[model samples]
Target: MIYSFKILQRYQLSKVILVVLLLIVLVVGAVPGYITGKWSWKNTPRITNFKDLRQIREEGLTISDLPTISHQKIRIADHNWLLQKVKQDNQSVILLLLTPNGPKDKPQVEWMDINGFNRWKTDSHQRVKFTVKIAGNGNGTTDSEKQSSNIEARFFRGWTNQQTYAVMQWYAWPGGGSPETGDWFWKDRSAMISKKRVPWVAVNILLPVEPLADIDPYLPQVKSIGEKIQASLMKEAFK
Candidate 1:
């Protein structure tokens, strides 16, 4: 009888352990989905209107705090405003969130503005090229110096022409030298170009460090960021 009782007690303990394990799994699985669903339910702002967005920014609420409309976020502003396509005047903005192809722990949100919402509108592309000098040594001398010079650059978006005349350029400058601004080309989709739009602002971004010259060692991460930025811009445009 004693042996039988012991075996029964052991079976009970085993059953308890299984129950506990099952409970843990259920909790663990449910928590993330619940949180994600909650997050998805919030409203995010669409870029089609900026006066409303300006109000949201001035109101000082983060995007996550807003209510949702049809599962789309109504307040789309991100923390990296300068890097996240914050607009001024009539210029469109672009933000490159993360680049390294590896898992990004940071939240990624892509936004764009079309038409020179608040930027200098130029008719000719030739007049738009300007120098952008980075104030550091690019000699690749010391490891620290090299790292300092190795800028993982990201840009906010603006345009000189309408969305049809958007330009994308990359440049670099040594500490005390003239800025070596690279070629600037229209980045607008051909459809916009065919539409004859003026004061066009198409927000685009070269994700952090992807467009910088001499950037083989900084691949994967740098390239990934650039690709993400580009993808984000395209996604926003489509939306």
Candidate 2:
């Protein structure tokens, strides 16, 4: 009777091992599919529908008449990335930020409600701007002296119906001649375009804001911004 019991126990142990092996194989096979699905989804331009609208509301963008939201994801490296053309007032705003691992994996909010953004501010007269002096690494954790430098410089938010057009001129011509900045706009863009554009270095100088630790801590906020911008775009597109 004892011998019979030992045989039964050995058989059950083998069955358990076999089950474990199968689970491992299943997980391994599923991994590729999971990665592919994510890649495909990220590559696709955002599509808004009723379901997506509901999600936008949950993120804190008040949708009284529904807002239009459109986004295209740009993956810079295996890790870092950015999202473009996220707007809330159906206005075009280019949000540039770090997309590190963990919570920072999502795009950091750089600019919102952007009436227009320029590589270089033109003419002290036309530009409505603000500058903050930043010295240390922009991580807000630094002493008040360092953190106080977080600055948002802009010329104008709404001067006419052509906000993005003026901004795009800066983006495209970059260093193109401008009567305001005394043609410094073209000089700056020319220099930036000439150099083998350094990753993140160029933008860091333009914004000069510090990193906010890991992204996870700020993901909810990021999602909320994305959704609102998306909803605003959707409302316009649907109209």
Candidate 3:
């Protein structure tokens, strides 16, 4: 990055020395970045594994525990509270569900915030306690723009009064890729709007927020569900 001609003018260094010095600078600058990327990629948790959660039914869980899909046209006045990631669209689709919090596992919710704004006033309906939100990726890529990257999504646990819901969601790309933090390969894919990959489907998985166990530990199960949903959507979309 540093272009220098005058530095060589004063040193009178031989061409061989200049070449070696330049190589050293380039190698020194490049190694750290390469190592960092490798480390990040290796450490990123693969939170989704559908195979492990086959017992979800045996654990007193059923599809009926989940909410069905619903879509609504966005009213002009309700723009302020659009789910941060899915906001650019004229309509929003929500998949909501709820489960019992037995005495052993009470729900601990960290409500939701969107575009630096809390979503209390604009909350219109309460079908399920949790509201899945597809949040924006800080770079300002909205639901309005087209994207080419894989997926970027997360969960927001929250409650309305005593009822709580675990809101899981992510951006679904036609070409699949994981957007979680240690997946540094996607750092480039999501960085630019021109290369950004966006799909309309947001994979949502709602579960009870159990106090005895953190939802994070079950992320692999959570991820599995999202992946299945994402795969089905991708197949239908690309077809």
Candidate 4:
């Protein structure tokens, strides 16, 4: 019985050592990742097949390249962007596509920067703030699945260059997108942990509001165009 007790004790001790070793390995692996994610910015994966503006088309809409002079007035060397005009029915909008051009580029923050806003002369008053929902067709029937199928984009109204405009923006991922930068940060961290690369694009849609016009009347149109632009990005640009 004494011998058996000794054997049992040895077994338990070995098991404990094994568990401790595993925990040490996990910590060692995770510590570097945590530090890297917290302090360093990862370069966006290169997109080899970024589609041309003329090559992208929605069912009932028309797209054409716009002169970049107005949009490029305050260009940053590390930021890359494209401007295009999209027309649907009798309505039209300017689509601004911003993406990371270097390791340090943060397109989301760049556009949201107060200094950049001031340079553009964007008014401080926001007429409205809302979200635009983009739903994807998924086979899952669960609530979580349904929720994942839907992406909410950020929208607001601001006056830039003395023109009131309806603005919508989001960061486009492979399957969907989110307006919150935190979502992208978490996703990129996960990708880093898995040794994978995920590409993203920042999209902005601008629709001019006529003088004395109510923006509420144009929300639907803006949402529709935003959805179309996102869908096109997912299908063509980010695929």
Candidate 5:
């Protein structure tokens, strides 16, 4: 009877030691992740029905109301893009909207680089490059929204086979705008730490410029139109 009692006590002590070891391991493993926010949970809401250009508009910009020259879906680098035109300030502007079509669709900024331009036969030759700043509404209820509201877009002057245009392009997200895919990667990593998910769309805007004219003269109009488009996308599609 005494031997049986000793055995039972040993079993109980072993169980208690095992439980303590497990708890220690759990704390050691979880504390660093928690401190670094590597284990943070973020909500990524899918943006839907964004293909309708009519639904996307800024206060002073008129979209798709003018005569449509070309409205079609063109494939580039294994991804499909919506190529359409909008009238801004009575000038026809070409807008290229690229969105993720499915779970497997991963969009990259390199898709629109020189080789991609060659594929489209645009014969694009990039010239002056600059950045446009879009002011935030300052009414964002969250930090991410506020930061994203005030973002910068990249613009450039480029020559196509037909004409010269002031082109502005960026990968826009609910959290902000990235001029390059690499910029988006770092922003996304930081956002993950902040427990935020940023889904993005590639936006390309082209405004016609007269040949032999200085591009500096056309920058104001490009900035105005670019700001409106970014703001409109944030207001409409992101919601």
Candidate 6:
């Protein structure tokens, strides 16, 4: 009887230890998520409307006046993005939003190949050629610099009819779980693995500044406004 009692005591002790270890493992695993998740929406910006965008920088163009929107259908391959051409006076901006449901069958998750403007994409159109870089498309830019907005507000400088146009684009995403800027590949790849629906917006703009030998002068305005818009929309999105 004593031998049987000893065996039972040992069995109970082992079972208790296993349960304690399991609890410790669960808490250990969940701690990081719990601590970091608290600030998920911390740095994200709020969502803004067209009016808010124009207000960011008016430049005496009277852009506040209701602008005209052209509902044009633009495609980036099997993915069909919602396209809008907003024109105010002599200034214009194109907005593209990638949605799961569009003219084409919905992709498991939507992705925008903003690489269409890269000069290598076409053989013709020699005179109006445009080159674009989005940081993580295997371009030499370091991951630290490509972390945000740089990929979104990609630079473009090209001439047509002896006039140069300076342009850029930015991708907008909500706060929580929003991929850091320029982390295009990692975010999408992770989404594909986890089967998470990726949501984002792209803003393309033709700056109102006069183009010169180089378009670097207009870059700051585009970047500042782009960041403002992102902050406005992202905070709202997460809210």
True lDDT of residue 89, candidate 5: 59
Q: Against the correct fold, how does model 2 do in TM-score?
A: 0.21
| True-vs-predicted CA distance for residue 134, candidate 3, Å | 23
Q: What tens-digit string does per-residue lDDT give for candidate 2 at 69-187?
A: 54343444343323334444454444432322331122223333121333333222232122222333445644553312111222221233222112211111111111133233323
lDDT of 6 by residue, 92-197 (tens): 6554444324212222333235444322221111111122223433557875433343233356564444445555554444432222344543353344333333
Backbone clashes in candidate 6 total 15
For model 5, how does the per-residue alpha-carbon lDDT over 192-231 read when each residue is reduced to its tens digit? 4444445667778778888634566777777666666666
Q: Which predicted model would earn the best lDDT?
A: 5
Once superposed on the true structure, which residue ranges of model 6 sit more than 4 Å away at CA?
1-68, 87-90, 100-152, 160-163, 176-198, 208-213, 235-239
Q: What's the residue-level lDDT of 3 in candidate 6?
A: 100
Instruction: List the candidates' TM-scores in order.
Output: 0.21, 0.21, 0.33, 0.58, 0.59, 0.40
Candidate 3 per-residue lDDT over residues 45-80, each given as its tens digit: 232322222222122122212332332322222221
Ranking by TM-score: 5, 4, 6, 3, 1, 2
Query: Candidate 6: lDDT of 164?
Result: 53
Q: Which ten residues in a row have the lowest lDDT in candidate 4?
A: 57-66
Error of 1 at 79 (Å): 18
Q: What is the lDDT of candidate 3?
A: 0.36
Candidate 4 — which pairs collide? Answer: none
